[model samples]
Target: MRFTLKQLEYFVAAGETGSIARASERIHVSQPSISTAIAQLEKELNVQLFLRHHAQGLSLTPSGRTLFQEAKRLLEQAGGLYAAASQMHEEVHGNLNLGCLTTLAPMILPELTLSFTSAFPKASVSPLIDHQERLLASLRRAEVDIAVTYDLRLSEDVTFQPLVELPVHALVGENHPLARESRTTLKELAALPLVFLDLPHSRDYFLSLFDMDGLTPNIAYRLTQPDVIRTMVANGFGYTLVNTAPRSNVALDGRTLTRVAIDGSHRPMTLGLATLTALRQTKLLEAFVSHAKSIISQGYIPGMMAP
Candidate 1:
Protein backbone atom coordinates (compact mmCIF):
# COMPACT_ATOMS: atom_id res chain seq x y z
CA MET A 1 0.00 0.00 0.00
CA ARG A 2 1.16 3.54 -0.70
CA PHE A 3 0.06 4.77 2.75
CA THR A 4 1.17 3.26 6.05
CA LEU A 5 -0.82 2.60 9.25
CA LYS A 6 1.37 5.17 11.01
CA GLN A 7 0.33 7.70 8.39
CA LEU A 8 -3.34 6.81 8.92
CA GLU A 9 -2.83 7.07 12.69
CA TYR A 10 -1.39 10.57 12.34
CA PHE A 11 -4.14 11.54 9.91
CA VAL A 12 -6.83 10.31 12.32
CA ALA A 13 -5.26 12.18 15.24
CA ALA A 14 -5.05 15.39 13.25
CA GLY A 15 -8.65 15.01 12.09
CA GLU A 16 -9.89 14.40 15.63
CA THR A 17 -7.93 17.20 17.28
CA GLY A 18 -8.16 19.65 14.32
CA SER A 19 -4.52 20.77 14.62
CA ILE A 20 -1.03 19.33 14.33
CA ALA A 21 0.04 20.75 17.70
CA ARG A 22 -2.94 19.29 19.57
CA ALA A 23 -2.66 15.96 17.76
CA SER A 24 1.05 15.84 18.60
CA GLU A 25 0.22 16.43 22.26
CA ARG A 26 -2.52 13.81 22.15
CA ILE A 27 -0.39 10.96 20.75
CA HIS A 28 2.95 12.28 22.12
CA VAL A 29 4.48 12.89 18.69
CA SER A 30 6.21 15.92 17.24
CA GLN A 31 4.10 18.43 15.27
CA PRO A 32 6.47 18.34 12.29
CA SER A 33 6.26 14.52 12.09
CA ILE A 34 2.43 14.54 12.24
CA SER A 35 2.28 17.27 9.61
CA THR A 36 4.65 15.38 7.32
CA ALA A 37 2.67 12.13 7.71
CA ILE A 38 -0.62 13.87 6.84
CA ALA A 39 1.02 15.56 3.86
CA GLN A 40 2.39 12.24 2.66
CA LEU A 41 -0.95 10.46 3.18
CA GLU A 42 -2.84 13.14 1.23
CA LYS A 43 -0.32 12.96 -1.59
CA GLU A 44 -0.38 9.15 -1.68
CA LEU A 45 -4.20 9.06 -1.65
CA ASN A 46 -4.47 11.90 -4.20
CA VAL A 47 -7.04 13.75 -2.07
CA GLN A 48 -7.18 17.01 -0.20
CA LEU A 49 -7.94 15.64 3.25
CA PHE A 50 -8.27 18.83 5.23
CA LEU A 51 -9.16 22.47 4.69
CA ARG A 52 -6.55 24.62 6.37
CA HIS A 53 -7.58 27.98 7.79
CA HIS A 54 -5.24 30.85 8.61
CA ALA A 55 -4.50 30.39 12.34
CA GLN A 56 -7.84 28.58 12.88
CA GLY A 57 -6.70 24.94 12.39
CA LEU A 58 -7.95 22.17 10.06
CA SER A 59 -11.38 20.85 9.16
CA LEU A 60 -11.81 17.53 7.35
CA THR A 61 -12.91 17.50 3.76
CA PRO A 62 -15.90 15.28 2.86
CA SER A 63 -13.57 12.48 1.77
CA GLY A 64 -11.46 12.94 4.89
CA ARG A 65 -14.55 12.64 7.10
CA THR A 66 -15.50 9.35 5.49
CA LEU A 67 -11.94 8.02 5.66
CA PHE A 68 -11.58 9.16 9.25
CA GLN A 69 -14.46 6.90 10.29
CA GLU A 70 -12.92 3.99 8.37
CA ALA A 71 -9.52 4.67 9.89
CA LYS A 72 -10.96 4.56 13.41
CA ARG A 73 -12.60 1.22 12.70
CA LEU A 74 -9.40 -0.12 11.19
CA LEU A 75 -7.38 0.94 14.22
CA GLU A 76 -9.85 -0.71 16.56
CA GLN A 77 -9.65 -3.90 14.52
CA ALA A 78 -5.88 -3.74 14.57
CA GLY A 79 -5.89 -3.33 18.35
CA GLY A 80 -8.23 -6.30 18.63
CA LEU A 81 -5.66 -8.48 16.85
CA TYR A 82 -3.18 -7.73 19.63
CA ALA A 83 -5.84 -8.45 22.26
CA ALA A 84 -6.72 -11.71 20.56
CA ALA A 85 -3.08 -12.82 20.63
CA SER A 86 -2.87 -12.07 24.35
CA GLN A 87 -6.08 -14.01 24.99
CA MET A 88 -4.47 -17.13 23.43
CA HIS A 89 -2.18 -17.24 26.48
CA GLU A 90 -5.15 -16.59 28.80
CA GLU A 91 -4.07 -13.00 29.39
CA VAL A 92 -5.99 -9.78 28.95
CA HIS A 93 -3.76 -7.08 27.53
CA GLY A 94 -4.75 -4.00 25.49
CA ASN A 95 -5.56 -0.32 25.67
CA LEU A 96 -9.01 0.44 27.07
CA ASN A 97 -10.78 3.72 26.33
CA LEU A 98 -12.78 4.40 29.49
CA GLY A 99 -15.31 7.21 29.59
CA CYS A 100 -16.84 8.50 32.83
CA LEU A 101 -19.34 11.07 33.96
CA THR A 102 -17.57 14.27 34.97
CA THR A 103 -19.21 14.46 38.37
CA LEU A 104 -18.37 10.83 39.10
CA ALA A 105 -14.82 10.94 37.73
CA PRO A 106 -13.24 12.62 40.73
CA MET A 107 -14.88 10.12 43.04
CA ILE A 108 -14.33 6.92 41.04
CA LEU A 109 -11.71 7.10 38.27
CA PRO A 110 -8.42 7.41 40.15
CA GLU A 111 -8.95 4.40 42.40
CA LEU A 112 -10.86 2.32 39.86
CA THR A 113 -8.27 2.83 37.14
CA LEU A 114 -5.33 2.22 39.45
CA SER A 115 -6.78 -1.01 40.81
CA PHE A 116 -7.85 -2.35 37.42
CA THR A 117 -4.43 -1.68 35.94
CA SER A 118 -2.78 -3.27 38.96
CA ALA A 119 -4.85 -6.42 38.54
CA PHE A 120 -4.11 -6.64 34.82
CA PRO A 121 -0.60 -5.26 34.64
CA LYS A 122 -0.34 -5.68 30.88
CA ALA A 123 -3.48 -3.62 30.22
CA SER A 124 -3.70 0.18 30.18
CA VAL A 125 -6.62 2.58 30.48
CA SER A 126 -7.19 6.05 29.10
CA PRO A 127 -10.06 7.98 30.65
CA LEU A 128 -12.34 10.55 29.01
CA ILE A 129 -14.53 12.51 31.40
CA ASP A 130 -17.53 14.49 30.23
CA HIS A 131 -21.22 15.11 30.84
CA GLN A 132 -23.84 12.44 30.12
CA GLU A 133 -24.82 13.51 26.60
CA ARG A 134 -21.24 14.02 25.41
CA LEU A 135 -20.15 10.70 26.95
CA LEU A 136 -22.95 8.90 25.08
CA ALA A 137 -22.03 10.79 21.89
CA SER A 138 -18.43 9.67 22.29
CA LEU A 139 -19.63 6.06 22.64
CA ARG A 140 -21.63 6.36 19.38
CA ARG A 141 -18.55 7.76 17.64
CA ALA A 142 -16.39 4.88 18.94
CA GLU A 143 -14.28 7.49 20.71
CA VAL A 144 -15.06 5.79 24.05
CA ASP A 145 -15.17 2.02 24.37
CA ILE A 146 -17.04 1.96 27.67
CA ALA A 147 -18.54 4.61 29.95
CA VAL A 148 -19.26 4.61 33.69
CA THR A 149 -22.35 6.77 33.84
CA TYR A 150 -25.94 7.10 35.03
CA ASP A 151 -28.90 5.44 33.31
CA LEU A 152 -30.34 8.72 32.07
CA ARG A 153 -31.91 9.21 28.65
CA LEU A 154 -30.06 6.25 27.16
CA SER A 155 -30.59 5.62 23.44
CA GLU A 156 -31.60 2.26 21.99
CA ASP A 157 -28.16 1.74 20.46
CA VAL A 158 -26.48 1.78 23.88
CA THR A 159 -26.51 -1.06 26.43
CA PHE A 160 -26.14 -0.30 30.14
CA GLN A 161 -25.20 -2.84 32.81
CA PRO A 162 -26.49 -1.64 36.13
CA LEU A 163 -23.89 -1.75 38.90
CA VAL A 164 -25.31 0.25 41.78
CA GLU A 165 -28.21 2.47 42.77
CA LEU A 166 -27.44 5.90 44.26
CA PRO A 167 -30.26 7.71 45.99
CA VAL A 168 -30.51 11.51 45.82
CA HIS A 169 -29.24 13.64 48.69
CA ALA A 170 -29.73 17.31 49.49
CA LEU A 171 -26.49 19.11 50.40
CA VAL A 172 -26.61 21.95 52.91
CA GLY A 173 -24.21 24.08 54.93
CA GLU A 174 -23.51 23.31 58.58
CA ASN A 175 -25.64 26.17 59.87
CA HIS A 176 -28.53 25.69 57.42
CA PRO A 177 -31.86 24.92 59.10
CA LEU A 178 -32.08 21.62 57.18
CA ALA A 179 -28.61 20.50 58.22
CA ARG A 180 -29.90 18.89 61.42
CA GLU A 181 -32.47 16.92 59.54
CA SER A 182 -31.66 13.32 58.57
CA ARG A 183 -33.98 13.54 55.61
CA THR A 184 -35.73 16.23 53.59
CA THR A 185 -38.45 16.21 50.95
CA LEU A 186 -38.61 17.75 47.47
CA LYS A 187 -41.25 20.18 48.72
CA GLU A 188 -38.92 21.33 51.50
CA LEU A 189 -36.04 21.72 49.04
CA ALA A 190 -38.17 23.55 46.49
CA ALA A 191 -38.88 26.26 49.07
CA LEU A 192 -35.16 26.88 49.55
CA PRO A 193 -32.66 28.36 47.10
CA LEU A 194 -31.13 25.59 44.92
CA VAL A 195 -27.61 25.41 43.62
CA PHE A 196 -28.34 23.66 40.35
CA LEU A 197 -25.78 21.23 38.88
CA ASP A 198 -26.62 22.72 35.44
CA LEU A 199 -25.16 19.96 33.26
CA PRO A 200 -27.15 18.86 30.16
CA HIS A 201 -28.86 15.57 31.02
CA SER A 202 -27.97 15.76 34.72
CA ARG A 203 -29.85 19.02 35.06
CA ASP A 204 -32.95 17.38 33.66
CA TYR A 205 -32.73 14.51 36.19
CA PHE A 206 -32.42 16.91 39.12
CA LEU A 207 -35.23 19.09 37.81
CA SER A 208 -37.40 16.05 37.23
CA LEU A 209 -37.30 15.30 40.97
CA PHE A 210 -38.99 18.62 41.66
CA ASP A 211 -41.30 18.13 38.70
CA MET A 212 -42.47 14.86 40.21
CA ASP A 213 -43.62 16.75 43.26
CA GLY A 214 -45.25 19.44 41.10
CA LEU A 215 -42.91 22.07 42.51
CA THR A 216 -40.38 24.42 40.96
CA PRO A 217 -37.02 24.96 42.61
CA ASN A 218 -35.91 28.45 43.56
CA ILE A 219 -32.65 28.27 41.60
CA ALA A 220 -30.18 30.60 43.31
CA TYR A 221 -27.10 29.59 41.32
CA ARG A 222 -26.29 27.46 38.32
CA LEU A 223 -22.89 25.74 38.18
CA THR A 224 -21.24 22.93 36.21
CA GLN A 225 -18.51 21.31 38.35
CA PRO A 226 -19.61 19.07 41.23
CA ASP A 227 -16.88 20.29 43.59
CA VAL A 228 -17.81 23.88 42.89
CA ILE A 229 -21.45 23.07 43.59
CA ARG A 230 -20.42 21.41 46.87
CA THR A 231 -18.31 24.42 47.81
CA MET A 232 -21.19 26.74 47.02
CA VAL A 233 -23.52 24.73 49.23
CA ALA A 234 -20.91 24.74 52.01
CA ASN A 235 -20.61 28.50 51.79
CA GLY A 236 -24.40 28.73 52.21
CA PHE A 237 -25.14 29.92 48.68
CA GLY A 238 -27.88 27.35 48.18
CA TYR A 239 -28.75 23.69 48.55
CA THR A 240 -27.96 21.31 45.71
CA LEU A 241 -29.15 17.78 44.95
CA VAL A 242 -26.80 14.93 44.13
CA ASN A 243 -26.92 11.13 43.90
CA THR A 244 -23.30 10.34 44.72
CA ALA A 245 -22.01 11.90 47.93
CA PRO A 246 -18.33 12.18 48.64
CA ARG A 247 -16.88 10.51 51.76
CA SER A 248 -16.24 13.82 53.40
CA ASN A 249 -18.83 16.47 54.23
CA VAL A 250 -16.16 19.18 53.92
CA ALA A 251 -15.85 21.18 50.74
CA LEU A 252 -12.66 22.15 48.88
CA ASP A 253 -12.63 25.39 50.86
CA GLY A 254 -12.61 23.31 54.12
CA ARG A 255 -16.12 24.39 54.96
CA THR A 256 -18.48 21.85 56.44
CA LEU A 257 -21.30 20.33 54.37
CA THR A 258 -24.12 17.94 55.17
CA ARG A 259 -25.84 15.34 52.96
CA VAL A 260 -29.50 15.00 53.87
CA ALA A 261 -31.28 12.06 52.29
CA ILE A 262 -34.27 13.01 50.21
CA ASP A 263 -37.53 11.78 51.72
CA GLY A 264 -40.39 9.95 49.94
CA SER A 265 -39.99 7.78 46.85
CA HIS A 266 -37.96 9.30 44.01
CA ARG A 267 -36.15 7.88 41.05
CA PRO A 268 -32.62 7.03 42.05
CA MET A 269 -29.93 7.16 39.40
CA THR A 270 -28.39 3.76 38.61
CA LEU A 271 -24.65 3.93 38.10
CA GLY A 272 -23.42 1.44 35.52
CA LEU A 273 -21.23 0.61 32.55
CA ALA A 274 -22.55 1.74 29.17
CA THR A 275 -21.29 0.40 25.88
CA LEU A 276 -22.33 0.55 22.24
CA THR A 277 -24.68 -2.34 21.59
CA ALA A 278 -23.20 -3.20 18.19
CA LEU A 279 -19.53 -3.10 19.15
CA ARG A 280 -17.85 -6.47 19.60
CA GLN A 281 -16.70 -7.03 23.18
CA THR A 282 -13.00 -7.71 23.31
CA LYS A 283 -11.31 -9.70 26.08
CA LEU A 284 -9.91 -6.52 27.63
CA LEU A 285 -13.42 -5.00 27.72
CA GLU A 286 -14.82 -8.16 29.24
CA ALA A 287 -12.12 -8.16 31.89
CA PHE A 288 -12.97 -4.59 32.84
CA VAL A 289 -16.67 -5.35 33.03
CA SER A 290 -15.95 -8.25 35.35
CA HIS A 291 -13.63 -6.16 37.52
CA ALA A 292 -16.19 -3.37 37.72
CA LYS A 293 -18.98 -5.71 38.71
CA SER A 294 -16.90 -7.05 41.55
CA ILE A 295 -15.98 -3.64 43.00
CA ILE A 296 -18.95 -1.44 42.22
CA SER A 297 -22.26 -2.37 43.84
CA GLN A 298 -24.95 -1.03 46.18
CA GLY A 299 -22.76 -1.75 49.22
CA TYR A 300 -19.49 -0.39 47.81
CA ILE A 301 -17.98 1.89 45.17
CA PRO A 302 -14.30 2.66 44.58
CA GLY A 303 -14.08 6.12 46.16
CA MET A 304 -17.56 7.33 47.10
CA MET A 305 -19.80 6.61 50.08
CA ALA A 306 -22.06 3.57 49.77
CA PRO A 307 -25.74 4.21 49.07
Candidate 2:
Protein backbone atom coordinates (compact mmCIF):
# COMPACT_ATOMS: atom_id res chain seq x y z
CA MET A 1 0.00 0.00 0.00
CA ARG A 2 1.15 3.53 -0.82
CA PHE A 3 1.07 6.45 1.64
CA THR A 4 0.88 10.14 0.65
CA LEU A 5 3.46 12.72 1.71
CA LYS A 6 0.63 14.98 2.85
CA GLN A 7 -0.48 12.32 5.31
CA LEU A 8 3.07 11.91 6.69
CA GLU A 9 3.45 15.65 6.99
CA TYR A 10 0.22 15.94 8.93
CA PHE A 11 1.29 13.13 11.23
CA VAL A 12 4.71 14.64 11.85
CA ALA A 13 3.28 18.09 12.54
CA ALA A 14 0.71 16.64 14.95
CA GLY A 15 3.46 14.72 16.76
CA GLU A 16 5.61 17.85 17.01
CA THR A 17 2.99 20.36 18.17
CA GLY A 18 1.28 17.72 20.39
CA SER A 19 -2.18 19.06 19.54
CA ILE A 20 -4.46 18.86 16.50
CA ALA A 21 -5.34 22.57 16.74
CA ARG A 22 -1.66 23.62 16.85
CA ALA A 23 -0.73 21.25 14.01
CA SER A 24 -3.59 22.60 11.92
CA GLU A 25 -2.37 26.15 12.57
CA ARG A 26 1.21 25.22 11.59
CA ILE A 27 0.19 23.31 8.43
CA HIS A 28 -2.56 25.82 7.53
CA VAL A 29 -5.29 23.18 7.58
CA SER A 30 -8.33 22.66 9.78
CA GLN A 31 -7.91 20.70 13.05
CA PRO A 32 -10.44 18.07 11.87
CA SER A 33 -8.58 17.70 8.55
CA ILE A 34 -5.26 17.23 10.35
CA SER A 35 -6.79 14.65 12.69
CA THR A 36 -8.40 12.68 9.86
CA ALA A 37 -5.24 12.72 7.75
CA ILE A 38 -3.09 11.41 10.64
CA ALA A 39 -5.71 8.78 11.55
CA GLN A 40 -5.85 7.57 7.96
CA LEU A 41 -2.03 7.59 7.71
CA GLU A 42 -1.69 5.47 10.90
CA LYS A 43 -4.34 3.01 9.64
CA GLU A 44 -2.66 2.74 6.22
CA LEU A 45 0.75 2.12 7.79
CA ASN A 46 -0.78 -0.47 10.22
CA VAL A 47 0.69 1.33 13.24
CA GLN A 48 -0.61 3.01 16.39
CA LEU A 49 0.79 6.52 15.90
CA PHE A 50 -0.55 8.67 18.74
CA LEU A 51 -1.42 7.85 22.39
CA ARG A 52 -4.25 10.27 23.14
CA HIS A 53 -5.46 11.07 26.68
CA HIS A 54 -8.19 13.44 27.93
CA ALA A 55 -5.77 15.91 29.60
CA GLN A 56 -2.62 15.31 27.50
CA GLY A 57 -2.76 16.50 23.89
CA LEU A 58 -0.77 13.66 22.22
CA SER A 59 2.19 11.34 22.60
CA LEU A 60 3.78 8.93 20.13
CA THR A 61 3.72 5.14 20.59
CA PRO A 62 6.89 3.10 20.03
CA SER A 63 6.01 2.51 16.38
CA GLY A 64 4.83 6.09 16.13
CA ARG A 65 8.31 7.33 17.16
CA THR A 66 9.97 5.37 14.34
CA LEU A 67 7.40 6.59 11.80
CA PHE A 68 7.87 10.15 13.03
CA GLN A 69 11.63 9.97 12.32
CA GLU A 70 11.05 8.78 8.76
CA ALA A 71 8.26 11.30 8.32
CA LYS A 72 10.57 14.15 9.32
CA ARG A 73 13.12 13.04 6.75
CA LEU A 74 10.45 12.81 4.08
CA LEU A 75 9.26 16.31 4.88
CA GLU A 76 12.82 17.67 4.62
CA GLN A 77 13.32 16.03 1.22
CA ALA A 78 10.00 17.40 0.05
CA GLY A 79 11.12 20.88 1.08
CA GLY A 80 14.32 20.49 -0.91
CA LEU A 81 12.32 19.40 -3.95
CA TYR A 82 10.08 22.43 -3.63
CA ALA A 83 13.12 24.73 -3.29
CA ALA A 84 14.71 23.21 -6.38
CA ALA A 85 11.51 23.76 -8.32
CA SER A 86 11.25 27.34 -7.13
CA GLN A 87 14.84 28.05 -8.18
CA MET A 88 13.83 27.51 -11.82
CA HIS A 89 12.91 31.19 -11.83
CA GLU A 90 15.39 33.96 -12.69
CA GLU A 91 16.79 34.43 -9.20
CA VAL A 92 19.09 31.80 -7.74
CA HIS A 93 17.60 30.38 -4.52
CA GLY A 94 19.51 27.32 -3.33
CA ASN A 95 22.55 26.41 -1.27
CA LEU A 96 25.88 26.83 -3.13
CA ASN A 97 28.78 25.01 -1.52
CA LEU A 98 32.03 26.26 -3.02
CA GLY A 99 35.63 25.51 -2.19
CA CYS A 100 38.73 27.65 -2.77
CA LEU A 101 42.42 27.21 -2.41
CA THR A 102 44.01 28.99 0.53
CA THR A 103 45.93 31.34 -1.76
CA LEU A 104 42.83 32.57 -3.54
CA ALA A 105 40.53 32.60 -0.51
CA PRO A 106 42.03 35.73 1.02
CA MET A 107 42.49 37.69 -2.20
CA ILE A 108 39.32 36.94 -4.18
CA LEU A 109 36.56 35.58 -1.94
CA PRO A 110 35.23 38.71 -0.23
CA GLU A 111 34.23 40.57 -3.39
CA LEU A 112 32.73 37.49 -5.00
CA THR A 113 30.71 36.70 -1.88
CA LEU A 114 29.42 40.25 -1.58
CA SER A 115 28.30 40.43 -5.20
CA PHE A 116 26.67 37.01 -5.07
CA THR A 117 24.78 37.81 -1.90
CA SER A 118 23.52 41.08 -3.36
CA ALA A 119 22.38 39.49 -6.61
CA PHE A 120 20.89 36.29 -5.22
CA PRO A 121 19.33 37.45 -2.02
CA LYS A 122 17.40 34.23 -1.60
CA ALA A 123 20.40 31.97 -2.12
CA SER A 124 22.93 30.98 0.56
CA VAL A 125 26.66 30.54 -0.07
CA SER A 126 29.04 28.40 1.97
CA PRO A 127 32.76 28.81 1.35
CA LEU A 128 35.28 26.14 2.24
CA ILE A 129 38.93 27.14 2.55
CA ASP A 130 41.40 24.38 1.83
CA HIS A 131 44.57 23.59 -0.04
CA GLN A 132 44.50 22.72 -3.75
CA GLU A 133 44.71 18.94 -3.44
CA ARG A 134 41.95 18.73 -0.84
CA LEU A 135 39.68 21.00 -2.82
CA LEU A 136 40.22 18.86 -5.90
CA ALA A 137 39.39 15.74 -3.92
CA SER A 138 36.19 17.39 -2.67
CA LEU A 139 35.20 18.22 -6.24
CA ARG A 140 35.77 14.59 -7.25
CA ARG A 141 33.61 13.35 -4.36
CA ALA A 142 30.87 15.85 -5.32
CA GLU A 143 31.19 17.43 -1.90
CA VAL A 144 31.63 20.90 -3.41
CA ASP A 145 30.11 22.23 -6.61
CA ILE A 146 32.88 24.64 -7.66
CA ALA A 147 36.45 25.48 -6.66
CA VAL A 148 38.85 28.34 -7.36
CA THR A 149 42.33 26.95 -7.77
CA TYR A 150 45.43 27.24 -9.88
CA ASP A 151 45.02 25.64 -13.31
CA LEU A 152 47.75 23.08 -12.93
CA ARG A 153 47.80 19.38 -13.84
CA LEU A 154 44.11 18.55 -13.46
CA SER A 155 42.59 15.15 -14.10
CA GLU A 156 40.34 14.44 -17.11
CA ASP A 157 37.40 14.10 -14.68
CA VAL A 158 37.44 17.87 -14.10
CA THR A 159 37.06 20.93 -16.33
CA PHE A 160 38.87 24.20 -15.66
CA GLN A 161 37.89 27.66 -16.82
CA PRO A 162 40.69 30.21 -16.61
CA LEU A 163 39.28 33.23 -14.83
CA VAL A 164 42.22 35.47 -13.84
CA GLU A 165 45.92 35.93 -14.43
CA LEU A 166 47.53 37.12 -11.20
CA PRO A 167 51.15 38.17 -11.27
CA VAL A 168 53.21 36.88 -8.36
CA HIS A 169 54.57 39.62 -6.12
CA ALA A 170 57.19 39.73 -3.41
CA LEU A 171 55.89 40.61 0.03
CA VAL A 172 58.38 42.49 2.17
CA GLY A 173 58.28 44.57 5.31
CA GLU A 174 58.56 48.38 5.20
CA ASN A 175 62.15 48.35 6.47
CA HIS A 176 63.36 45.65 4.08
CA PRO A 177 65.75 47.00 1.41
CA LEU A 178 63.95 45.26 -1.45
CA ALA A 179 60.72 47.07 -0.60
CA ARG A 180 62.19 50.30 -2.00
CA GLU A 181 63.06 48.90 -5.41
CA SER A 182 60.94 50.00 -8.38
CA ARG A 183 61.28 46.60 -10.11
CA THR A 184 63.46 43.76 -8.84
CA THR A 185 64.76 40.55 -10.39
CA LEU A 186 64.61 37.10 -8.75
CA LYS A 187 68.38 36.87 -8.91
CA GLU A 188 68.67 40.08 -6.89
CA LEU A 189 66.01 38.94 -4.38
CA ALA A 190 67.59 35.44 -4.15
CA ALA A 191 69.92 36.55 -1.37
CA LEU A 192 67.05 37.21 1.04
CA PRO A 193 65.69 34.33 3.15
CA LEU A 194 62.38 32.92 1.89
CA VAL A 195 59.47 31.68 3.94
CA PHE A 196 57.43 29.06 2.12
CA LEU A 197 53.76 28.18 2.54
CA ASP A 198 54.84 24.48 3.17
CA LEU A 199 52.25 23.04 0.74
CA PRO A 200 53.73 20.72 -1.85
CA HIS A 201 51.90 22.29 -4.80
CA SER A 202 52.51 25.86 -3.62
CA ARG A 203 56.15 25.05 -2.89
CA ASP A 204 56.49 23.63 -6.38
CA TYR A 205 54.83 26.70 -7.86
CA PHE A 206 57.04 29.08 -5.83
CA LEU A 207 60.21 27.16 -6.68
CA SER A 208 59.29 27.15 -10.33
CA LEU A 209 59.44 30.95 -10.31
CA PHE A 210 63.10 30.86 -9.32
CA ASP A 211 63.80 27.82 -11.52
CA MET A 212 62.62 29.73 -14.60
CA ASP A 213 65.41 32.22 -13.95
CA GLY A 214 67.93 29.41 -13.42
CA LEU A 215 68.46 30.49 -9.79
CA THR A 216 67.47 29.21 -6.35
CA PRO A 217 66.51 31.62 -3.59
CA ASN A 218 67.74 31.08 -0.08
CA ILE A 219 65.22 29.35 2.20
CA ALA A 220 65.13 30.40 5.84
CA TYR A 221 61.55 30.16 7.13
CA ARG A 222 58.91 27.62 6.06
CA LEU A 223 55.24 28.00 7.00
CA THR A 224 51.81 27.19 5.60
CA GLN A 225 49.68 30.12 6.72
CA PRO A 226 49.73 33.51 4.98
CA ASP A 227 49.30 35.37 8.25
CA VAL A 228 52.37 33.74 9.70
CA ILE A 229 54.38 34.85 6.69
CA ARG A 230 52.82 38.30 6.91
CA THR A 231 53.67 38.68 10.59
CA MET A 232 57.21 37.49 10.09
CA VAL A 233 57.72 39.88 7.18
CA ALA A 234 56.33 42.80 9.18
CA ASN A 235 58.87 42.17 11.91
CA GLY A 236 61.70 42.23 9.32
CA PHE A 237 62.18 38.51 9.85
CA GLY A 238 61.93 37.26 6.21
CA TYR A 239 60.38 37.88 2.81
CA THR A 240 57.84 35.76 0.93
CA LEU A 241 56.20 35.63 -2.49
CA VAL A 242 52.45 35.95 -3.04
CA ASN A 243 50.11 35.71 -6.03
CA THR A 244 48.33 38.96 -5.14
CA ALA A 245 48.61 41.76 -2.62
CA PRO A 246 46.58 41.54 0.56
CA ARG A 247 42.96 42.19 -0.42
CA SER A 248 41.96 43.63 2.91
CA ASN A 249 43.83 46.14 5.01
CA VAL A 250 46.46 44.08 6.84
CA ALA A 251 48.07 46.14 9.57
CA LEU A 252 50.83 45.34 12.00
CA ASP A 253 51.29 47.99 14.66
CA GLY A 254 49.66 50.59 12.39
CA ARG A 255 52.04 49.78 9.54
CA THR A 256 51.00 48.05 6.29
CA LEU A 257 53.21 45.61 4.40
CA THR A 258 54.32 46.41 0.87
CA ARG A 259 54.05 44.16 -2.22
CA VAL A 260 56.83 44.82 -4.72
CA ALA A 261 57.18 43.68 -8.31
CA ILE A 262 59.18 40.53 -9.13
CA ASP A 263 61.10 40.49 -12.39
CA GLY A 264 62.97 37.71 -14.36
CA SER A 265 60.18 36.93 -16.84
CA HIS A 266 57.91 34.52 -14.88
CA ARG A 267 54.43 33.60 -16.02
CA PRO A 268 51.37 34.72 -14.07
CA MET A 269 49.53 31.95 -12.26
CA THR A 270 46.30 31.03 -14.07
CA LEU A 271 43.56 30.93 -11.45
CA GLY A 272 40.57 28.94 -12.71
CA LEU A 273 37.13 27.75 -11.74
CA ALA A 274 36.93 23.95 -11.71
CA THR A 275 33.90 21.70 -11.83
CA LEU A 276 33.43 17.95 -12.15
CA THR A 277 33.03 16.66 -15.71
CA ALA A 278 30.50 13.98 -14.76
CA LEU A 279 28.20 16.30 -12.82
CA ARG A 280 25.34 18.00 -14.60
CA GLN A 281 25.63 21.77 -14.22
CA THR A 282 22.94 23.32 -12.05
CA LYS A 283 21.52 26.73 -12.97
CA LEU A 284 22.64 28.29 -9.69
CA LEU A 285 26.18 26.97 -10.11
CA GLU A 286 26.35 28.16 -13.69
CA ALA A 287 25.18 31.63 -12.72
CA PHE A 288 27.72 31.81 -9.90
CA VAL A 289 30.57 30.79 -12.20
CA SER A 290 29.50 33.32 -14.77
CA HIS A 291 29.44 36.12 -12.24
CA ALA A 292 32.81 35.12 -10.84
CA LYS A 293 34.45 35.03 -14.26
CA SER A 294 33.03 38.40 -15.08
CA ILE A 295 34.26 39.97 -11.84
CA ILE A 296 37.76 38.54 -12.09
CA SER A 297 38.19 39.55 -15.72
CA GLN A 298 37.16 43.17 -15.18
CA GLY A 299 38.38 43.88 -11.65
CA TYR A 300 42.13 43.46 -12.02
CA ILE A 301 43.60 45.24 -15.00
CA PRO A 302 46.55 43.50 -16.58
CA GLY A 303 49.74 45.57 -16.80
CA MET A 304 53.30 45.86 -15.54
CA MET A 305 53.20 48.18 -12.51
CA ALA A 306 54.22 48.37 -8.88
CA PRO A 307 51.76 47.27 -6.20
Give a tens-digit lDDT track for model 1, residues 123-204. 9999999999999999999999999999999989999999999988898999899999998889888989999999999999
Off by over 4 Å in 1: 1-90
**After TM-score superposition, what is the CA distance of residue 219 in candidate 1 from its true location, in Å?**
0.5
Error of 1 at 270 (Å): 0.3
Q: Which digits, one per residue and each the tens of the lDDT, describe model 2 over residues 34-150?
A: 888988897788889999977679999999999899899988999999898776665667989889888668667777887887887887789999988898899999899999888
Query: How high is the CA lDDT of each candidate model?
Result: 0.92, 0.81
Candidate that would win on TM-score: 1
Q: After superposition, how far is residue 204 of candidate 2 from its true place, in Å?
A: 0.4
Error of 1 at 255 (Å): 0.6
* Per-candidate RMSD, Å: 20.6, 14.6
Instruction: Quote the RMSD, in angstroms, for model 1.
Output: 20.6
